[model samples]
Every structure is written in structure tokens, then in C-alpha cells.
Target chain A: MKSAQRTTRRPLALAVAALVGLPLALSACGTSTAASSSEAVTEISVMDYYNNEPDKSFIGDALTKCGTQAGVTIKRETVPGKSLISKVLQQSSSKTLPDVLMLDNPDLQQIAATGALAPLSDFKISTDNFAEGVLSAGTYKDKVYGLAPTVNTIALFYNKDILDKAGVTPPTTWDELKAAAAKLTAGEQYGLAFNANPTYEGTWQFLPVMWSNGGDEKKIDTKETEQALQLWTDLVKSGSVSSSALNWTQADVKDQFMAGKAAMMVNGPWQIPALDKQPTLQYGVVKIPVREAGQTSVAPLGGEVWTVPQTGNKARQAKAAEVIACLNSDENQMSMAKVRNTIPSKTTLAEKFAAENPKLATFTELIKTARARTGELGADWPAQATKIYTAIQTALTGNASPADALKQAQGQ
Target chain B: MSLTTDLSQTAAPSSGKASRKHGRPAGPPTEAQAPRRRTRQRRERIFQWLFLVPAVVYMALFFGYPVVKNVVMSFQDYTTATFFTGEAPWVGLANYVTVLSSSLFSTSLLNTALFTIGSILGQFVIGLALAIFFQRKFPLNGILRSLLLLPWLLPLIVSSAVWRWILDKDSGALNRFLGDLGVINTGVPWLTSTSLALIAVVGVNIWIGIPFNLTILYGGLQEIPDELYEAGSLDGATGWKAFRHITWPMLRPVVSVVLVLGVVYTLKVLDIILGLTNGGPANSTQTIATQSYDLSFHEFKFGEGAALGNVLVIISLVFAVLYLRASRRAVDE
Candidate 1:
């Protein structure tokens, strides 16, 4: 009986051990580290910063269509607009970086400084066809890293009714602006809405006054810089513009203007769609006013570039460059302009795209007068820029002198 | 001597107990022993192992290894990127120094401290009072106790998001109502203002914490001997004075656990603040948790992120030690 029981249990023990061992052995075998063939088409991924659903779809559609026809597949990712550079930096560290990417214009320098992205001198395209000043803005270390995608600049968006009620035209100089703002100041109807919450807007608004006074941020912190800071600070403190304006978003200003609370605003073409969204409001768009005589109008030079990621087999990388070249074509530019409401990067295509879409003409003019901000600010750019608005807030809130605030900012 | 004597006695019992216990006069082959003795030994071994396995496995996976890994990582300069790149650089204390000197580090520490002090104090006081209120067999007392937990039942994100809507400048109910009543001039920048945003986040967190406090504390209050209170009442103790003299001292242990956990939870609060303000208006509301995320995601500085995470671990370790000491003292008393 004992021998018989031992015989019965022996098979059961062996069977159970086999069941356990089989799965472990299979899993261990399945997890083998496989290396890819160098000669194979190395997949290159591309990241685009068209976070808005419409823009994302538009870019997605075009890239999908183009990549399909090329007989090479392209993997793509889209990121939110608010944190493009930061997101890209994080992605870049994966070392599986997309062979193509969209980066903020100013951050191209910082990207270059890091040596994480490749320069585009090797890619074959008529980069000269790129809009003037775009090359300058996107160029870092004497190498091009991005294909200029558009030329975006600042423009004044005003509520026609508010301006009419104040009986004032958009002010063209510092004195006229102050005068008009003071005149527009009435029972809760402010003349202009600007955020002291530092942003690209603050820098864009800051420089025109300096340019009008024959100064630049790179050359010197001139009297014009001080004067311009004071001018806006005074407007904030005078209650002509709500000091709270320093704290509100450009979107908030747009909402205020649509509601008839704000009369005029220093904004760009992006607001036209939002303004047009307001059914009750009558609005006008115009070039940013000249700060001084013979001073060229300016908004920060705003645009993006397309560059290949550092990963990929040679063939796929070449194909990626081909896709970028195809995008640089007038056909692609016009298509993006048609679908995205963006001005074309090429001067000639700019006119073509503009003629097809009349609204883009406003942006074309703005882009010509644009100057890009510095890129050293990196991911902290938003926080550092917030100090601009904070400075403005301090002066408006009666906490500090405008000069004192600006002086403190120079150190920051 | 004991083993030999016990075995010899068992050997001699080959004739006696087996016949009595088994009752079937079966032949004993080798030995006879106490019938329940083997069962008792096996049971004692099983219970000992059963008690040990859960705690051993838990400590091995969750506590022991993680603590070891964290300490090792603290001595290295590594980021998430380093995981793919293989070995990380040796930075020995550089990361710790950077973390210590950073504005992000200091500001977040201060913010977390305030949140802990405010939220813990509010939850304890409020929950204890509610406990006493509900201790009596009053009408709808059960229903009221259930209703009180609704705040804790609501998801933190849900509460924060809803509160954010309530505090909106133009469309918010708070601003609109206050402005309509002539209580204020215009929409208050409740979230946008640097001074006001952190307070708003903390208020929501405190609200979420109250229900847990109430339930645990109410249960604690129920367990207290009624005779003690009766004696106190006989001695003329009543109302607030009675609670001060009787209820509080008895409920101290429960209160300690609630307060310490609340402090730890509040100290590392990221979601409430992030969901509400994202540490904006110049990062006035930035906390260590938010900064950790920013460093990892925004800055992509993984080594620094690890350092920050280790700081939180160290803080929790300190709290654990304090809790251990206090609980032991309470038990000894």
C-alpha cells in the first residue's frame, strides 16, 4: 500500500513542478534583449506642438497623408502649447528622440546650447525662402535647427464701440496712449487691458517703447526702457487700466473687451477669432502703434521650426528630411495656411496665403516688425517672466516704485 | 535530562494511553505519545508562521527594499533618463546641496508647513466637537453621522475643481453673490491673487479631512467607559468642563493618530494645489510635491526629482519614529 501511494504521488509532484517551471522558463525566454538591424529602416518619431484639437487634426491629417505617399511611415506625437520646450527637453532625454520636432523659436538657442538636437545645415531645402528675420530668430550657433513655419507678430485688438465712446483713435505714441487711456478712464470703463502677469506679452509690450526711444534690451537698459515701464505702471496705478489687468490673462482681456469693459488691448491676430466669437461686440484689428517717430512697429517675432530628431536609420532620416522639404514647398504652406489660419513662412507664399485668406494679411505685417525674445530663460521662462507683471503689480498696488521694481527685475 | 525522561516516559506509555485514548486495543509498533501533543506543536508552528509571513513579505517588498534603494539613489546623481543610459554619475551630496539651496525647496517647505498646521488643527478641533455632539442617542443621529462623511467621500479633485468654479472671478457664485450683496466692489481674484490662492487650496483640503476625523473620533468616544463620565457628573463636572476633564484625556490617543496622519498627508499635498492653481501667480502656492513634479516633468531633471522624493521619505520616516515613540509611551502609561 505504501509503495503504491508513493508511486501515485511521484507523478503528481513531477507534473506540478513541470507546470511551474514551464511558465517561468517561457517568460525568461520571451524577455530576451533583441537588437535591431542597422540596415533596417530605423523608425523616426516626430513631435508637433499643435495642442489645440483643430490644429492637431490639421497637422495630423497633412503629415499622415504625406507620410503615406512617401512609402515610409512616420510616428508622431503632439504636445500642449503651454509647455512645449519643457516637454521636448524631457522627451529628448529618452535618447529615442523624434527625428523631427516643433520647438518654440526662442528655445532653439537653449536647445542648441544643450547639443541635444541636430542642426539643419545638412538638410536640402531653400532655407532662404524662409521669411526674413525668421532665420535670425531660429538661428543659433550659426546653424539652423528649425524651418520657419510662420511669421507671427503683435497687433492691437480694440473694441470699436469702446473706442468710439471714448472718441479716441488707437494711440500711436507714448504720450497719445497715456492721454487716450486717461480720457477712456471713466466709471469702470478702462482704456486698455494688459497683464502684469509676465508673459511673452509683457516682453512684447515692453520692447516697443524701448525701440521707439532708440534702445534695445541687448544693448542697454536705457531711459526708454525705464520710461516705457513707467508709462504702463502709471496707467495701471492711475486706474485708467485696471491694475487687476496686470493679473488677468490675455484671454481675460479678450473677454473684458467683448463685454465692453476694456476699450483697447495690445494683442495679436490670435484674438481675432476670439473677438469674432463675441456676437455683441464690434472690434477692429490694426498694427501695433508706433512708439516714436520713425520707430518701426514691433511685436516679438513669433514662429516655429520643423527639424529632424536625432534617432533613426540613415534611410528613414533621409526620408524625414524629404518630408520637411515637402512641407517647405508652396503647396504645403498654402495648405497649412488654408487649414490652420497661419501665415506662410516664405515671403512669396506669405502673400499667396494672405491673398487666399484676408485675415492672414494682418499677421504678415506684424511678422515683418517682429523681434524674438532671448531663450536663456528655459523652462523657468514663465516664472521669470511673471516677475515683469509682478513688478507692475507692485507699482500699481502701491507696494513699490516702478523704477525699483524694474531694477529688481534686471537682477532677477 | 528533560528530553530523555520525557521520551522514556512516552516510550513506556506504549501500553497505557494509546489503549485508553484510542480505545481500540491496537498493537503499538514503536512508541506511544501524548495524542494532543503533536497537534499542539504543529498548531503553534503554523500560527507563528502565519503571523510572520504577511509582515515579512510586506516589509521586504514595500518597506525594506525601498528604503535601501532610496538611500542608495540619494548618493548618486541620477534622473529617469539615467535608467536607460545605464550607470549614473556619482554626485555625492551635490544634489542634496542644490535641493537645500533652491528657492523651490524653501518655498515649498514653508507652504507645506502652513498647510499642515492649519489643516491638522482645524480637522482635529472640528472632528472632536462633532464626535461629542453625535455621542448622544439623538434624532437622525445615525443619518447625521453618515451625512457628515460626504465631504470625505467626495474625491479631492472633485472638491478642488468645484471650489475653483465657486471662486472664479466673473462667473463664480461666490464673487457674483458677494458683489450683488455689495459686500465687495468687484470679482475677487481668489485664485489669481498670490496671497489668497494657497488659503483657498488649504480650506478645501481641510474640508475633505473632517469626515475621517469625525468617524474615527466618534468611534473612539463611544468606547470610553460610561462610569467614568457618570462619576464625573456625580462630582458636579458638566458640559465643556466635563469634556475637558474627562473626554479629552481619554480621546488623546485617537487624536494623536489623526493629527499625525493629517500632518503627513497635508505636508505632501500636491493634487489639491495643482488642480486648483498650479502654483501660479509667480509660484506663490508652489509646494514640495508640485516642485518634484515640475523638476521631473518640466525640468526633466530626474536626479533632482529623486532627491526631492527622498526628502519626503526622510520626513515621513521622522514622523514614523515620533509616532512609534508616542504610541509606546501611551501604551506604557
Candidate 2:
């Protein structure tokens, strides 16, 4: 009986031992393969957040083209927009970061501050001729860590038929905008729609108005900022803009505009393709309205920047830098800009891009004066952005007066 | 003799000695035989324990590790950089302090309580009514009962998205139908108004939870034998009186289980609220779970998020303990 029991226990112990050993053995095999492969990386991996189409295919083509230029076969990976940073952080901890990484421009500083990215200067990559806003966005501690080929900013997109029918011109100043919006308001449709949801996107939309009104982010409680908040509150209070603007995303705003429930919207050039899909929806783009006649529309710059992450693989890092450079070359920038409905980040290509794509002339001009969200606060922008959006929500929801909302949010 | 007498003789030597003292028939155990018998019993106990090993290992791997890690994380200053640097400096109770003392904490707590209570009450009351309604022998009752589960079958996110369109202020089907009936002059701002967002979110959540409650309660109702009802009728205890005495008392166990499970599930509900309102319109619908996610993912404040998450866990644990006690008392009675 003892001999038979020992036999049974031995097999059970062996099975438990195997179950414990399997994960360890598999992880060991994984690290060994990675170590061996990193020694001579013929194919460097690239990761980005272009998970949607047209932009995905466009970026894919550019990456493949750049990979050929760098003499490396590219292994591209794409995650959804929201999960890219989380994926990067996960890879960072595991010491298995991709050779090439794409970060939304405002996110570059936060990621670079983690010491996970190699400065472009390390690989002798040129950082010349890029627009100042985008350059500032990709810079951390005065070191250029990433580069964007094309950039975009929000502008006032209006339905031509609605404006024409209402005999209202595209508003150029805050006062003009208010009057035009109020005049255009009719049954079952609001005069304007813009996102003021309690999110960073809401903060982004409000920046153009706030900055144009001389509302500095550094001191958000100032009268100038209050004026911007009051503008949104007034629009909602006047019933010219939907109270539902508090819940609409930029996409939702676009949908309302297309559905004729909204005559104008604050949106980016990315909506051009979707707008073109509806042939009867004639729309015109202009700079986001200014506070006064001479005040510039300093819209927040929006774009994705490519960087070479510090993956401890010198060969792959060098190759990734080459791909980054090739992607930012004027020719590739112009091509990508055309396909993605964005303007090249290099100011020198503005005239050429504008002449080639006349419909985006307003955006081309707007890009020159666009401001980077992180230009002032660096890694601290998210905190300030949260404050801005909270204030927007408080004011828009009528929970507080504009001045009181700013005061309360700034306290936070 | 029998196996019982033989086992007693070998296994319980002291008892056998006592029996001998009382002048009963007993075989005295030899020294070598006693040790061998002890070993055999020990081996059998080990065999019985082996059957539970898989479950114990699974719980340790999945539940134990995460709970321990989350507790450890709540005491540290974990952030995005910590993921890369692996240097989570100890901050003691600072994370908990920040989370508890924040301005939004009170709002989020109130919202969480309201959301859970509102959802459970709505789901249970409506579910019980439907379950009782279906107890009758109507035509196509089985098919109709099965069809009622369609809402629960669809994914929460898909339902949330569908509900979002249906609840839109202007172009929504709900407003359109209301307008056709001349209910109001203008569209009701369902999800966009601070006053109405929470109620709208709760309505959608109730819709999602009804099917689950109905199914469980229906099963419990089916388990109660019909003879009790027949006897209650003989005593003139029909209709509401029968339900009060016969059905309610017997259904307490299942009802407690359903309500406790519902509260637990509703307390952790993030996806439906996120997909529908995203805790927007001035954070009117911002529950503790959504706020925790916002802290961890949006603000990258994992430590504070874990601290808030632990608070939710403790709340759920309190409910779970109360449930266990209630169910035990019911069994005793």
C-alpha cells in the first residue's frame, strides 16, 4: 500500500512541478530569443496609434518607404488612440520597447520626461526647418526627442448653404461670431456646436477661443479667460448653441453639423474626408474667430510625432532615427499632408501645400500661428488642461458663473 | 466481524481499550500495526486534500496576487514614470488622504450610492413583477420568457451605444416618439443636462439589469413547489396573502442572493456608464468606479486610484458579509 501511494504522490508532485516550471521556462526562452535578436536587428519594430483607415494606410506606406531608405524591414504595430501610451509604458517597464514609437505631440513631453526616448541629436538627426509649435511639442528639457511631419489645428467649419440662406458671413471676431450664430439659430437646429465635455478635447477646443482672447493658460483666473468662458456660457444661454454641447465629442459635433442640426462647428481638418463623403454638404473652413480684429487665432497644434525610443539596441535605434528623418523629409511630408488632410509642419512647404490644396488654405494659414499645448507647461499640461475643461463644464452647465467657475477650477 | 468493528479496533486504540475496560469484545493493537494504520489514514487525508489543490492555486494566482499588489500600490507613489523606472517611493497613507479629501470625492460617493441603490431597486421590483406575471400558464409562455433575455445577451457597450443614439436630445427616437405623441414642445436633454444625466444613466442601467434579475428570480420561483400555494388557498390565503406568506418566505434566500450580487455588480459598473455618458455634463454621473479609472488612466495616478478602488472593495465586502449572515439566519429559521 505504501509503495502504491508513493507512486501516485510522485506523479502528482511531478505534475505540480511542471505546472510551476512552464511559465518560467517560457519566459526564459522569450528573453533569450529577444537578446539574441537584438544583437543584429535587420528589422526594427515601429508602433503608432493610427489604428483607423486612410491615415493608417498612409502612415504604413510612409513607414515602409522610410524603412527602405534606412535599409531595414519595418515591423509596424498600431494600437487604438487611447491605449498607445499605456502600451508604451508597459513596454517600457518590460525593457522591450519598440525601436520606433509615435506619440501625439502633447504626449511627447510626458513620455520623454520618463527617460524612455533617445534624443534625435544622439543619432545625428537634423531638427531644422520644423514649425516652432511642433518642435516645442516634441522637445523636453531643451532636447529634441521627436519630430512631426504634418500638423493640424481646429478651425471654424461652417455649412455654406445655411450661412448663405441666413445671409450671414463666416465670423471673424468674437462679437461677429456671437451675432452670426444668434442670427443663424432657427427651428430644430442650433447656430453652432462645439464640444465642452469634461475632457481634454473640450480643453483643446476652448484653447483657440481662450488664447485668441488673450487668456493665458498660466493664469487662468484672469479676466481674459473669464471673457472666453463667458462667450461659451452666453452662447448656451442665448440658445444659439445646444446645451448638449456639454456632451458632444468633436465627432458628435460633426455628425450634428452634417445632420443640419448645427450650422457651424469648431473642428479640425481631419473631418474633411467625412465631409466630402456627403456631396451635398457644402462647407467652408476659416480660422477660429479672434477676440478682436487684430488678435491672432492661436489654435492648439494637433499632430503625432515619431521618435526613437531608448530600447538599448544601438543598431535598431540608428535605423529608427533614419526612418524618422525620412518620414519628416519635405517630399514625404507634402505627400502625407495631402493624404491626411493636414498641413506640413515645415513652414517652407506651406505655400506649395496651400496652392496644391486650395480648400485647406485657411488651415495652412492657421498652422503658422498655431500653439503647442505643452509649449508652456511641458509635462504639467495635463493638469492645466483638466482645470480648463472643468471650468468649461461648470460654466456651460450653468452650475456657476464664468468668473466663479474659473476661480473654482483654478483653485483645483 | 464487520468493517466498522475492524476499523475501530485498528484506528481507535484508546477507545478500544476503554471498551475492554467496560468488558466489551476488543482486539488489542500491536505497535507496528498502529503506526501502519496511522500512515494509511494520513495518506487518505492527503488524497482528499489533493482534489482542492487546483482551486486553491487558481484563487491564489488570480485573486490573492492582485489584491496584495493593489494594497501595496496604494501605499506608494505609482505613476507613469514608475512603470519605466520601477521606483515607487513609499508615500504611506498620502494616496488615501488625497483621494478621500479631494473635492470630487463626496460627489463621486453620492453618485455611486445613488446609482447602485437606484439600479438595484428598479431592477428587483420590475424583475419580481415580471417573474410573477410569467408564472401563469399563458400561451407561448416559454418562448416569451426566453425572448425576455435578449437584452442581457447583448454586450453592455453595444447596448450603451444604441441607447446613446436613442436618447439623443434632438434626433433621438425617444424624443421623436414623444414629440409625435405631443408630450412636449422641445426635445428633452436626456444625457446632456446635469439634472437629467444621472437619471438617464440609471434608466439605461436598469434596462440592462432587468433581464438578469428576472432570470434568477424566475428560477427561484420555479423551485417553490405548488402544493404550498394550493394549501394556502385552502386556508383562504390567495393572491397577495399567498405571496406574502408562502412565496416571500421561501424566496428569501434567492432574493438575498440576487440583491447582494446585484449590488456588487452595480458598484463596479464602469463600462456602461463610460460608454453612455463618460461621467460628463459637469460630472453629474461620475461614480466612484469611473473616477477611479479616470485617476489611473487619465491622470496616471495609479496609487490614488488603487486607494479609491480599495474603498469600493471594502464597501462590497461589507455587503457580502451581511449577505452571508442573512442567508445563514434564513437557513436556521
Candidate 3:
């Protein structure tokens, strides 16, 4: 009887082991061997978040070209935009960080502060002719850790057909903006649409209005910020902007404009390629409207920056820095700017590119005054950005008055 | 001093007392048998442990490490810097204090409770109704029952995205349907409204959860013997009366399992809410899970995020213990 019971239990035990062991075996299989320094560095690993098509292929080609020039093969890994930072943190903890890394500009300071990125000054890379805002975005604690090949900023993108049919010009000031939006409001289409969701994108979109109105991220409770908040509040309350703007991303706002559900939207030049695809859609770009006519539009600087992560391999690091510098070279910058529809990071290159591509001229001009989101606050900007978007959502949803919302969020 | 006597001395107490009542004589081992028996027993114990090794290792690596790390991190000043430098200063409940004291914490707690309760209640009730309906013999019954699994089978993110479009204020199918029926002239801001966002999210969750509940409850329904129903009918217990007397009381065990599991799963739902509203429209749909995610990923406050996560785990643990006790009671009954 004991032997019979043992026979039955043996199969069950084996089944249980197999069930539990399969995933363990699979997970163990995943740890790839990294290149040892003893061997000559033949390949350098690069990680970035341009997983989407067009940008993915575009950046991939550039990386390959630059990698060839630096005498190393590029092994690139692309992740979704949202997951990049977490992946980096995981890689950092494991000491498996890639030789080359890409970070969204505002995130560079935070990552650099963590001591995960090497200063470009170590490789003696030149920073001449680079846009001041772009340079500032890449700087943390008096050291530049990253550099961008191209940069972009949000602007007022108007559906020209709707504006033409309505005989309304694109608004240059907040008053005209409100008037044009209210007048264009009819049927299913809203007069204007912009994102005010509780995310950093919302904060970025709101900055053009806030900064142009002389509002400061350092002190968001100022009267200038409140006025900007009030402008957003008034637009939503008047039914000119949809209540749905509270949940819309910039992509959704662009979709609304493209489908003629919105007469205009606040977006960036990255959307130009998608817009240019639609032959029937007549659109025009302008600097985001200022609170008053005399105010200069101050949009937030938006772009990705490439950096050499501290992988503890000097030769690989040097090669990675070479690739980064090559990416920002004038030829690569101009070509990438044309194809990607972003302004070159270098002022001279950007000016020449804008003169050639009139459609991006408005964005190029805005990039001149564009403030880096992390310029003043450094790594603390994320906390402030959360507050800004929270205030925007609260005000837009009518949960509180703009002034009250700003005060409450500032205190939080 | 001989091998037989030594073997008998070691194995007698452990094996004899239990076997004595079964009429098996406690005999002394012979010299040749003693060595072989001892080796076999040792081998059996080794084999048993060998079977457990894989499971133990798997649990230690996957579940145990992450949970212990999360608990420890909650008491430290863990941040992006800690990931690089491997230095997380011990803060001793400072993270818990800050997370608990925040205004959003209260909102998230309340939302979590509402979301879990609302989703479970709707899922259980509707799921039971569908289970009972499917129990009846009908044409296309099998096909219809399988089709009901579609919502659960689809990826949560995909379902949420589709629901977002279907619930859009201006051009949503729901609004169009309502408009055509003359029930409402204007489209309802189902997901975008502060008042309705949580409810809409709960509605979507209920849709996703129904298939699991239905499949389990339907299996419970199938377990009831035909004689019980026949006897109940003869005793003038029919339909709802039969259901209350025979079906529910018999399905009690399965129901408890369904409800407890539903509460636990719904408590930690992140993807659907993130995909649909992202705890937005003025922080209306914000739950503990989403708030924890935002704390870590968006704000880079890993300590606070871990603290919030531990709080959620504690909530789930309470439910888990209750489930254990409830199951014990059911077994006794």
C-alpha cells in the first residue's frame, strides 16, 4: 500500500516541480552576457524610447550611421515612451545600464543628479552655437550631461479651412483667442481644444500661456499665473472649449482638430508630418497666443537628449560620446530637423532650416524664447509640474475658482 | 548493539504507535532488512524535499523578494538616486506619515473603496443573473455563453481604449444611441465628468469581470444535482423559491470565492483606469493603486509609493484572512 501511494505521489510531485520550474528556467534564460572589457569593444548598446514608427526608423538610421563612424556596432533597444525611465532605473540598479541612453530633456537633470550619466565635458564635446534653452535643459549642477540634435515647442495650430470659412484669422492675443473660439463654437465642433489632463503634458501645454503672461514656475500662485488660469477657466466655462479638455492629451486635441471637431489646437511641430499627410486639411501654425498683444510667446522647450550612461567602461563611454556629438553635428542636425519636423538645436542651423521650411518658422521662432521646464527648478520641476496640472484640472473642471485652485495646489 | 536492534530503536516509536491500532504488529527488524529499510526511508525524505525545491526557489525569487523589498523600501528615503548609488537612508515611517497625511490620500482611499465595492457588486449580481439564464436549456446557449467571455478575454488596455471611444462625449456610440432613442438631446460626459468618471470606470471593470464570475457561478450551478431540484419542485419550491432554497445555499462556497477574489483583483486595478481616464478630470477617478503609481513613476517618490503600496497590501490581507475564515466555516457547514 505504501509503495502504491508513493507511485501516485511521485507523478504529482514531478508535475508540480515542472509547473513551477518552467518560468524560473525561462527567467534565467533572459540574462544576456554583457561585453567584458578584456575583449576589444566591438559593439556599444544604446537604449531610447522612440519605439514608434518613423521616429524609430529615423533615429535608428542616425544611430547606425553615427555608430559606424565611431568604429562600433550599435545594439539599440527601444521602449515605449512612458516606460523608459522605469527601465533606466531598473538598469541602473542592476549596473546593466546601456553605454548610450536617451532621455527626454526635462528628465536629464533628474537622471544626471542620480549620478547615472557622465558629463559630456569629460569627452571635451563642443557646445558652441547651441541654443541657450537647449543647453540649459541638458545642464545639471553646472555640468552638461546630455545634448539634443533637434528641439520643438508647442504652438497654436489652426484649421485654416474652418477659420477661412468663418473669416477669422488666427488669434495672436488671449482676447482675440477667446473671441475667435466663442465665435467658431457651433454644432459638434468646439472653438478650440487643448490638453488640461493631470500629467506633465498638460503642464507643458499650459506653460505657453502662463510663461508668456509673466507667470513663474518658482511661484505659481502669482497674479500672472492666476490670470492665465482664469483664461483657461473662462474658455472652458463659456463652452468654447470642451469640458472634455480636462481628459484630452495633446494627441487627442490634434485628433479633434484633424477631424474638424476642433477649430484649432495647442500642439507642437512634431504633429506637422501627420498634418502634412492629409491633403484636404489646410492648417497654419503660429506662436501660442499671448495674454496681451505686446507679450512675447514663451513656450516650453520640448525634445529628447542623448547621454552616455556610467557603464564603467571608458572606451565604450568615449565611443558613445562620439556618437552623441556626431548626432548633434550640423549636417545630421539639419537633416534630422527636416525629416523629423523639429528645429535644430543649434541657433544658426535652426535659423537656416526655418528660412527653408516656412511652415516650421513659427515653431523655430518660439524655440528662441522657449523656457526649459527644468531650467529654474531642476529635478524639483516634476513636483511643480504636478501642481500646475492639478491646478489646471481643478480650475477647468469648475471645482474651484482659478485663483483658489492655484492657491490650494501651491500649498499642496 | 547489532544493526537490527539499532534500526528498531530509531523507527519504533515513530512508526509503531500509529500502526499499533491498525492491528499491525511492531516487530523487530532483521539484520538484512534493517539497512535497506533505513536507506529507503532516507531516500523517500530526500525525494520529498527535492520536489519542494523548485517551488520554494520560485516563490523566494518572485513573490518573497519583491514583497520584502517593498516593505523595507517604505521605511527608507528611496528615490531615483537610490537606484544609482544604492543608498536609501532609513526614515522610519516618515514615508507612511507623509503619504497618509496628504489630501490626495483620503481621496484615493475613498475612491478605492468605492471602486472595489461598486465593481464587485455589479459584477456579482449581473454575473449571477447571466449564470442562471445560461443554466436553462436553450438554442445557441453554448455559443452565447462563450461569446460573453469576449470582454474578459480582450486585453484590459484594449478594452479601456475601445470604451474610451465608445464613451466619448460628442461622437460616442452610447450618446448616438441615446440621441436616436430621444432619451437625451445632448451627449453625456460619461468619462470626462468629475461626478461620473469613477462610475464609468467601475462600469467598465464590471464588464471585464462578468465573464470570470459567470463561468465560476455557472460551474457552481451545474454542480447541483437534478434530484435536489426535482424534490424542491415537488415540495412547491419553484423558480425563485427553489433558487433561494437550493441554488444559493448550495452555491455559497463558490459565491464567497468569487466575491473575495473580485474584491482583491478590483482593489489593485491599474491598467484600465490608467487607460480610460488616468485618474483624471480633476482627480475624480484616482484610486490608491493609481496614486501609488503616480507617486513612483511621475513624482519619483519611491518611498511614498512603496508605503502606499504596503497600505493596499494590508487592505488586501484583511480580505484574504476573512476569506480564509469564511471558507473554513463553509467547509464545516
DockQ of each: 0.11, 0.28, 0.30
Better candidate by TM-score, 1 or 2: 2
- Give the better candidate number (1 or 2) by DockQ: 2
DockQ of 3: 0.30
Give per-residue CA lDDT, model 3, range A294-343, as digits (tens): 99888899999999998888888989999999999999999898888999
Interface Cα RMSD for all candidates? Answer: 13.0, 7.6, 8.7
Candidate 2 runs further than 4 Å off: A1-39, B1-30, B33-49, B330-333
Taking the tens digit of each residue's C-alpha lDDT, what string does model 2 give over A247-330? Answer: 778999999999998999999999999999999999999898888898888889999999998877777788899899999999
> Candidate 3: where are CA atoms >4 Å away?
A1-40, B1-43
Using lDDT as the measure, what is the rank order of every candidate, best first?
3, 2, 1
Off by over 4 Å in 1: A1-44, A49-51, A79-94, A106-115, A151-154, A185-189, A198-224, A266-268, A374-398, B1-112, B134-165, B168-172, B185-201, B222-236, B274-317, B327-333
- Cα-lDDT of candidate 3: 0.90
Model 3, residue B277: distance off in Å is 0.7
- Per-residue lDDT value at A348 in model 1: 70
Give a tens-digit lDDT track for model 2, residues B1-333. Answer: 243244434655554454467665666665645666677667754765586578656754566556766887899999888876778999999999999999989999999999999999999999999999999998999999889898899998999999998998888899999999999789899998889999999999999999999999999999999999999999999999999999999899999989998999999999998888889788899999999998888877899999999999999999999889878876786
lDDT tens digits, residues A3-121, model 1?
A: 44554465446544544444444423322232334575535567878878777887787777667666667788887776776666555555556667777676666565556555677
